[model samples]
Target: MLSSLIFLLGLPLALVAEPPTCTPLIPVTFDNATIPRLLGHWIYITGASKYGPHLAELKELKHAVFDLFPGSHEDELNVTEIMRMNETCVTRNTSKIQVFWHNSTLVHADDQVTSMAELIQSDKDLLILKHFNNNFPGLSLSARTPNVSKERLEEFKTHLHCLGFTEDEVFFTSEKDACPLPGEKTGEGSTEPQPE
Candidate 1:
């Protein structure tokens, strides 16, 4: 009887373990040649899956339909894109996508990320993007991938310079570990596949 009580008491402690903290990957610059490929549609999962919403969007891409979550809005907001052109060129990249707010929604999305003023200096493999915002914690939704290339990334650097963003203002994440998949949500308005 004493052993049973001990086991029951210890079970609660074991179950109270803290969840693993995300190893936040730093942000990279536009010079990374792989940036363009990473800019387009990507399979993203958060907390548990980095590719959750991303994979579903990919399946839709094969059907030639690109859909952004929460639909469209007419207000200023932030967005992220994971573009893909060829299977082999499925590299990871990040861009500070923006949308203008109007009537409580975003009307248009902007790809002018001002942070990446300098060229990428490392030869890493993965890319990570974190939106720096102080008001209204932004939703890390998927973005409509941009059709950028090597020349395009270079061109973008000048564009950022024109926009007045300096080199040090930008940041890059280390290219280690597997790119995570978007996790599955289990409540109303969740991105899980529902019955037809």
Candidate 2:
């Protein structure tokens, strides 16, 4: 009779579903020595997320280029995002990052944590980032140029599967007009398309 009672209690515990596991997540940048090497210009390629809003934002994102600069404080980074939306070159220069040990994250000036970043793969030319947020995790693939290779993209999909993300949630960036740099005199997205 006692054994029957124990079995009944254990059944409830077994019925509870366990949270999904994402593994084999190797670090792309681990220590201070390796972190510095990741800083530079990067072109946004594609992103995948289960969050509705984040996925929507990614879908709307045609193309983006960003520069990672050293901040006033150590282990901090200043990220300037450059994109073109509706013939308008939109540039945002306030996002800051606080690089941490192990897995790092993007932070704000107020010290508010934005999104946790995990590097999955980087071949100098291609990079993959997995972001673990409050309730949603997102994966991003970047490259030196918008033109990415088929192998890299396939690898990204494999990582996405491990994260429990679906192909429907993936958003591919459409490379187009790029915004001018700080002091470049070109109507990057201001005028009509030029002839070939």
Candidate 3:
């Protein structure tokens, strides 16, 4: 009876002495991102998916644009995604974005849907978004302008490699007229698909 009591008294201390294990692919976020800086039109440059089931369909998306605006709440933002589907159809999807700190080092933006991207890297000219959940793990690159410098592209590739992606896995979208011209209507049936 005395030995049993001693073991019980030491159990709590043993459990408290154990250290937590950190995963290699822990999510990261940028804390300096603000609404004004993130607002504006951005062009989709390239993307890499590690294990997405819809990767093939994503590859068929030849062009995309992300237009961000301030939301009704201070911590929210409205994001409009315009994507060219199958080289012909243009689809516009809008979602509300709520930016909050997942932790001290990670910032997460969720659209309250299947789209949740972590702000891994952001700069004046480039932004890198990472999506990893039960559905899939992917990385997307966007730029302020359609024409990204070669240096930046190389840097992006390096970042992908760090994230366990090879050159063959990375797919880059075409930059030719990727976005609609000013004043052009992007509604359904506004334009017909053209053959490649």
Candidate 4:
């Protein structure tokens, strides 16, 4: 009878889901990310995330490009993201990002929700960003150029492993044609043909 009772009590414990694990390295913000230097274009090289809006779907993403511009407010930036879907369709999104420097780190916010990312390392050519939320840990590598060199890619992979991510969880992206210039009609919602 005691054995049966213990088994019954263990059933609920087995059903309870365990919390997700995260890397120990905290996100570090760069103090030198000036507005002018951050502006212009950047291409996505690779990224890994366990949870987010489209974490799984992003694995299939072919290409992504970002264009940063000055915002109306001095502390804000206008960000445009062009993402290629399945090598056929491209999607464009725009958001206003508010940034603040605090505790020697940079915090980014959109619509009042804040996300912190550490600038693990960066230079004139490449930028490494690492973010760890309770259940949403992510790492991304970007470059000024569309195509990054193999050596650079290998360095990024090393950083990924250092952040507790496995090779299978990470995916790389390529650069296609540059995103259309601002306000030239993206046909965002319609079935119109996208630019090649």
Best by lDDT: 2
lDDT tens string, model 2, 1-196?
9999999989888778553345576766566655566678889888887666566667667777887788888778888878755455567777887777644544334232356676765687766777766678888888877778787787777778777878787777666556566667665335332211
Candidate 4 worst ten-residue window by lDDT: 187-196
lDDT of 3 by residue, 13-44 (tens): 98997643322433444355445667888888
Residue 15 of model 2: what lDDT? 73
Off by over 4 Å in 3: 1-33, 102-113, 177-182, 185-196
Error of 2 at 114 (Å): 1.8
Model 1 C-alpha lDDT per residue in residues 1-196, reported as the tens digit of each score: 9999999999988778653333332234333233333333433321011233332433333111122333233221224332222221122222223332221122222332232111222222212233332221111212233222465344334433333334443221212212222353344432322111
* Model 4 pairs in collision: 28-118, 28-119
User: Per-model C-alpha lDDT, please?
Assistant: 0.29, 0.70, 0.66, 0.65
Q: Model 1, which residues run further than 4 Å from truth?
A: 1-12, 39-129, 139-196
Residue-by-residue lDDT tens digits, candidate 4, 47-98 = 8977664466566677777777888876777876666666455544446656
| Winner of 1 and 3 under lDDT | 3
Which candidate comes out best when scored by TM-score? 2
Give candidate 3's whole-model lDDT: 0.66
Error of 1 at 88 (Å): 34
Root-mean-square deviation of each candidate, in angstroms? 17.9, 9.1, 13.0, 10.3
**Alpha-carbon lDDT of model 2:** 0.70
